[model samples]
Target: MGVFDSHKSFGKAILYTCSAESKDFFKVYESSDDKNVILSPLGVFTLLLLYAFGAEGQVADEIVEFLGAANKRHLTDSYRKLSRELSSMDPDLLAFSDNVYIDNQYSLNNSFILNAYSYNSEADIIDFRNPKSAAKTINEWVSTKTKGKINEIVSEDDITYDLVVGLYNVIFFKGHWAVPFDESETREHCFLTDDFQLIKKPMMHLLKSLDYFEDEGAGVRMIQLPYKESKFKMVVVLPSHLNGLSMVLRQISETGLLHYVNRMNHSEIVINLHLPRFEIKSEHDLKNILPKVGISSIFHGDAYGVVNEAPVSVDKAFQQAFVVVDEKGSTAGAATGLHITYTSLTPTIPFKVDRPFLFAILYDDIVLVAGTLSH
Candidate 1:
C-alpha cells in the first residue's frame, strides 16, 4: 500500500513533488476571489509524502542521518530537548531539518572543590557518557543550543544536569481546516456560517484548464494547484464540496495520491476555492503531547531499546508551530525541539516569509512540506 493509504494525511506530501509544467496552476492562487491556488506536478508529490511521513519514524531518521557521526553527539543530545518541545505540540504532522554549530565564544570552563579548592577545564562536547556529569552538560548544552527552546535535555532527574553544546532542531505539523468549503464559483457576496451568520471573507475562484477530475464513485471533486517558484511544488486534493470534509478525509488513502496527480494533464475546468484566513501560533510544552503520539512510554520510562549499556531513552521533546493561510496563497511552518540525550531541535528556523505564495520541501519522492492561499 502507498504511504497515503494510511491514517496520515497527504496534503503536506503532494506540494513537495510538483514539476515545471504543472506549476502553472500556482498562478491561480488569489484570496481576493480573483486568483486561485495553483500547483505543479512536483509540488503535488512532495505534499503527498509530507502528509504520509511527517509523523513516521522516517523523518527522525533523515535528520539523524543528515547530521551523521560528524555531529551526532550534539544532535543526539539536542534531539532530547527538541523532542520535549515537539511532545507539547498538537499538530497532525510537521517537520523540518537544519544544521547546528557550537558557539566557541560562549564556551566557559568552571571549577569544583578539591579540599575547597579545585577546578577543571574539560572540553570536547562534554561527554554525556558520564551519566552524572553528562546529563548536566547535556541539559545546559541543549538549552544553550536552542536558546532555551528546550530546558532539560535529559530528564529522569539522574540523567540531566547543566552544560552547553550545539543542537539541530526539526519541526513537523498537520492541521485540519476548521471550516472546509467547497470549490465553486462563489458569488461576490458575504460568507456565512451554518447558522447563517454573515462574515466578510475573500473567496478564491479558478478556471483550471488541466489537472481536473470529479470522482463520482468516490463522490468528490479533485483539483491540483502548483506553485510558481519551481516545478516540484503543488497542492492537489479531493475538495469537500461533494461530501462533508470528514467523510472525504476518511475516503482518502495513500494510493489516491498518484491517481490525483498523474491523471491530470491539460483540461479546462471551473473551480471556486474558499478557505478562511487563519493565523495559528503555538508554544508547546513537551511534557503535554508526547504521550499522545506514542513516544511517552519510552521517554517517560527506563527504556528497553538498549542493551548492555546505561539506560537509553529520550528525555524531552517540545516544539512551536505556525501557519498563516489566506486567499492569495499559504505559508505553514514548524519548529520541533527535543532532547534525546542518547540523540536533536526545531524543524525550521528563522525565515523571511512574505506575500502570497506556496512552499514545500522535496527529497526524491518524499515531499515533506507544502501549503498555500496566503493572500
Candidate 2:
C-alpha cells in the first residue's frame, strides 16, 4: 500500500516513534540535575530517514525499522506528501527545510538526491576537508532556512577531514496564543523545584476558558492553547505536585502520551493559568543518544548504499534547538545535522510551569518539538 493511503496510520507511527525516542532522549539528556532542554524529535527523525534512504543493507534496515516505515521509499514518499500538505500552510507558523552536502570526492545516488529535492531538500557538493569555509556555507543555509534564529548548526570544531556527507534538517515555528495573557497581569511568583528550593520568576497570568483536563491518576493536568489558525497548538502537562515532574516525565511513554492526548480531546474547563516565560537553547551530540534508541548500525558499521564505491560510516551527529515563550507568542527553531556519522509532550491544567514541567509544540497530533523545563 502507498504510504499516503495510510496517512492516518503513518502519522500515528510518526508520533509513536517520536514519543519513544523522546523518552530515551529524556533519560539520557534531561535526566541530569538542574538542566532545561528542548528537542526537535521530528527534525532528528527526518534527517535520519533521509540518510536511510541513501543507505542500504543493515543500516537501512535498522533505520527503516526504527522509523516505523515499511521501506525507505515509503518513508520518503510519506514525508514528501507531508511537506506538500505543509507547504500551503501559514509560513509564519511553520517552516521546514532539508539539505545534504556531499564532499566532491564522492558520488551520491541520484535517485536518493531526487527524493530529497522532491521534498524541497537541496543537495550541494562541497569540500569537507576545508572545514572552515564549508561550515560557514552550511551554517548560512541553516540560518536562511530558520529565518536567522538558528545561525549555526555546524562549527569549525564539528567538522573534520573524515566527514564525507552531511545531512541537515531545519524546522522553525512561531505561534501566538489564541487567548493571550495580559502583560500587566504578569508578576514575580515563587517557583518551587524538586529540591524544595524556591526562585522568583516572571509568571504570566490569564483566566480563560480553555481545553483542559486533569488526570489524577497520572498526577498531571493538561491544556491545549491554540495558535492563530488553530491548526497547531501548545499542549502543557503540569504535575499536580510542585516536585512531581520526575514522575510525570518517567511516565511519558507512547501509549501513555497517546492516552493523555485522547483523554484531553473529551475535556475542557476554565483555567487560571500561571505560566512562566522561559527560553531554552540546547545543543546535543546524538552520538551518545541515538545509539541508545536502537540506531547503532550507522555509527561504526560498514554502511553503504548512499554513495557508490566508497566505505563511509557516520562520524558525528548534532542538533541545535531554541525556544522562547513570551507575553505575545512563542518562537522555536531547531536544526539537526549528521556528518556521515549518523544519527538519529504535554499538558495543562491550572498549568503553572512555575517550577519544572514538560511542553510540546504540535501540528495537530504530530509533536514537532518537545522538552523539559527544570530551572
> What is the RMSD of candidate 2?
3.7
Among these predictions, the greatest TM-score belongs to 2
Name the candidate that leads on lDDT.
2
Q: How does candidate 2 score on lDDT?
A: 0.76
Residue 121 miss distance in model 2 (angstroms): 0.8
Q: Provide the overall lDDT of each model, using Cα atoms, as 2-decimal numbers.
A: 0.34, 0.76
> Please, what are the lDDT tens digits per residue for candidate 2 over residues 1-375?
322446655565566544453434464445445467788878877887888766788888878777677777777777887777665566677888788898888878777777777777778899888989999999999898788898988889888867778998888998888878799999999987656779888999977667777778878888877887566788887888877776776666546355577677544456778888889998888877878777888887775567775656788888899899988889998999888832322333355677778888887667788877777
**Candidate 1 RMSD to the real structure:** 15.5
Residue 238 error for model 1, in Å?
Answer: 5.2
Q: State the displacement of the C-alpha of residue 347, model 2, in Å, after optimal TM-score superposition.
A: 20
